[model samples]
Target: MVSSVNNPAIAMAEKPPSLEKEPMADVEVGIAVTDEKDDRPGEGFGEVSDLKRGLKQRHIQMIALAGTIGTGLFLSSGKAIARGGPVGTVIAYTVVGLLVSTIVFAIAELSALVPLSGGIIRPAEYFFDPALGFAQGWNTTYATAMLLPSEMVACAVIIRYWTEQVNNAVWITILGFLLLVSNMFFVGVYGELEFICAILKILLVVGSVIMGIVVDLGGGPKGHRLGFQYWKNPGPFVQYLGISGSWGQFLGFWRVMGSAVYSFSNVENISVAAAETENPRRNIPKAAKRVFVRVLLFYITSMFVVSLVVASNDPGLSKSAGDASASPFVLAASSSGIHVVPSIINAVVLTSAWSAGNSAMLGGSRVLYGLAREGHAPKIFTRTSRFGIPYVAVLSIGLFMVLGYMTLEDSASTVFDWFQDLVSAATYVHWIIIAIVYLRFYYGCKKQNISRDELPWKSPFQPYATWVALVSFTILLLTGGYTVFLHGEWDAETFVSNYFNIPLIFALYFGYKVFRKTKMVSLEEMPIRRFIEIYQDNPEPPEEPKKGWRKLNILW
Candidate 1:
């Protein structure tokens, strides 16, 4: 495989290198790093204009944290519990965590092998079939796009917790627009804002976890020792959903496990964020290795702390576990028998949701830009605003945010439920693809006889771990359609969740293929290196933070 941006737009006085040629007779076409010169007008078989490397290590770290813990975890964990029972949910999350770590390790290895603007997608073309790589990349892009709206919807829901006046739908719409404006400006500013937001999210997660641990350890929410009776009496397993204390008689515990999976989905986004980091070789692997441990610490540990103090069925908890304001952290604090921690938690949820949403938009736009650079999509996506932001793609993805807000026009929670179902189902498709792509790439590497040592970071267990993640992810995607199987209230969950993904993805993939005459590229014929080299925009490590904001009183 060769570097893709061997020819940058700037300082190329020498004649351009030849690109791959196409055949008129053959129905199948492939993209490879050859020199035949098809020289198609819109689809230039030339080097992409090399982009700047402005992102620092701190940005990558914060994005790694913020990206992994979305509102899905904060809000939907209750739903997962409702579906999978405590025991089932526990096993599912742990399993998902294990699988996610493996796929990301595979990804980290690939990123180290070929770090490009295209990131993981770059390996697909080199290692697997080019068509597979393109399809996987595009689908992942849509999945990322879905996140922006979901996060904004989360933002609106958080805001509604504070007021009864404004319609929640209206608030979502407003917030989406504001977020769009922020992202459309410049990448650096967006990075800076996101950095601050990430810090706030970390503080909230750390503070709330510490407080909950203290409260549960006999310090008392109200000077009364809760003493972990929930664990003993509820018996760790719940035994029964409504059977008072038995763990077996549950209605929807599996459903709860489903929610837990979503919480962990953002964990993989860290690899995507690594693509844009300044010193990827140094940072992407570091971030990927730490992300898994950090997720275990932040998510499992914090939830463990919450379960100690608050019962799964705590009434003080928001009736809508899907709402950020109703997060276990805040509700448990409200029951804290303590002071203003509940209110503070609610405030934290608001910022956390915002940061998650921003990260989604940021990733989606970057992916879209990468698409254009590969000559697979239109050129407009390549255009960046003065702020070095992909203004057009950002606007396009942010438009989805309105989908979440439009539901707010109704007082009934029906719209929110439907939106959640759609996003949840769509999200599964994305995860499934991520796993499949990585696993396929692993096998493809074998077919080509690539060595593990050549990979920057190696996945511990080769085929077994990748298959485990793929199977488990596929299970979640299939089970996501359970609502469709119900005899009554089919309309409640809506057809969107059950049937939308296949068509949406096919339309985008095949439609572009026919329009651009793109076809399957052979593994050897794939453009492995020419386009990938530009991804190594920065091959060095970034500097550490110079300022200490916590020390100042009026710093901001």
Candidate 2:
């Protein structure tokens, strides 16, 4: 039942409402049923979402898979192997993967209960402080804006691998135009394209792993077995910065943690467009539960295979080609005298870059729309086309594509590296905010004597998992620029890139807090019960069982 008291603090100032006492006859399911006369778009759930619920179960699953399996894994893993060696690289990725699993569970629990746009940003306002909501909303927007241009620049570099005669500007412009056009139409258009791209990426990753095994077993044209020879010769860890000792090996492992963060950057974006997803309470949790398995299967397994087939000291791993030539899989295949791997890996990696840009565009625009809904941004961003596309928000973020032109003057490879560091730092900040918001939500439940069984979905390791993630992400963020502190290793660009987001988020948080005078919502007054009531009232239909050929399809 929609409570007559819109303000949870006022409703619970005296005592928590008994479930039996609340009326349910007139309560509408799924959407808010408030009596207030606010006509603003998305002011409350009562009016129904103006955005189309065109995303199906498969679309949500593929988007979750597509967002994380991009240029981070395709192109950047080479750098990780170079700096950390085989064993160190695996350790870094494994640690980050476990932390990311906890984040997925925390967000899944929250998004399952209150599946709103802007992902965790909307919940931050109701469960924690409104100022926090504003800060994270803009933090995500800024990060996504920077990400789009980075992907566009990557697309240009990928094109140069085939031929250098064509100017990089030409590829950037073409790719930028395609990205803008794809997001301007109905969201289903974007979903379908992502579905196709995700399938291609899955195939490529699996194919590369199998090929790596073949090369390692002396099944290649060269007939040379390379079973852990690199690890034995070069050792299990790198002596980073010409330092020679166990300490240097440890630093090498720690350094790869940042690169690991970049590889796993957008794994939490699965629920960003919750309002546009059909039966999100069911679909979101399903996707979240499967994410851990996907990470292990697609990421860790690939890294293990790459380590076995390719040496850590391969000169091509550090090449500035910014294309398939630098991919560890491509390098391994070429060394084994296999001629077909480069062209195939290059084709898929190119699409992966473009797909990453498309995802950033969609995510950034929806976040802007959610910010406008909560009055954190200008109202103009709330405007949508008749097709339910957020046109104004799309155009606002699309303008950032112009940043890709910087590659024309400077080296494309250099520009791509700059964006990699900057975006990775921003991603750490984003994950930190998610952990904080989840902790607040978890405590809010406890303070009110609400049972975890009552929630739509309760994650496995509450409070504890989130706590570990919070501390680990903070350390990573602070040490992201540690190389600059070493003797004769200072780089102004590196320091600024790693540390800039720290101050930017603080300024946004306190600025909004002081100006708006928004107070933190007390734990006792959190709206957990109200959202629980909504979930109970809205019962989704049972999923149909798969049959015939569909039964074989388990990827989703």
**lDDT tens string, model 2, 354-426?**
9988988888998898888777889799888888888999999999989878656347776555667898899
Candidate 2: misplaced stretches above 4 Å? 1-48
In candidate 1, position 22 carries an lDDT of 33
Worst 10 residues of 1 by lDDT: 6-15
Q: In order, what lDDT does every prediction score?
A: 0.58, 0.82
Which residue pairs overlap in candidate 2's backbone?
32-45
The estimated TM-scores of all candidates read 0.79, 0.93
Clash number by candidate, in order:
39, 1
lDDT of 2: 0.82
Top model by lDDT, which number? 2
Residue-wise lDDT of candidate 1 within 264-341, one digit each (tens)?
655666555444456566566766777668768777776666666666556544366334445666666666656566
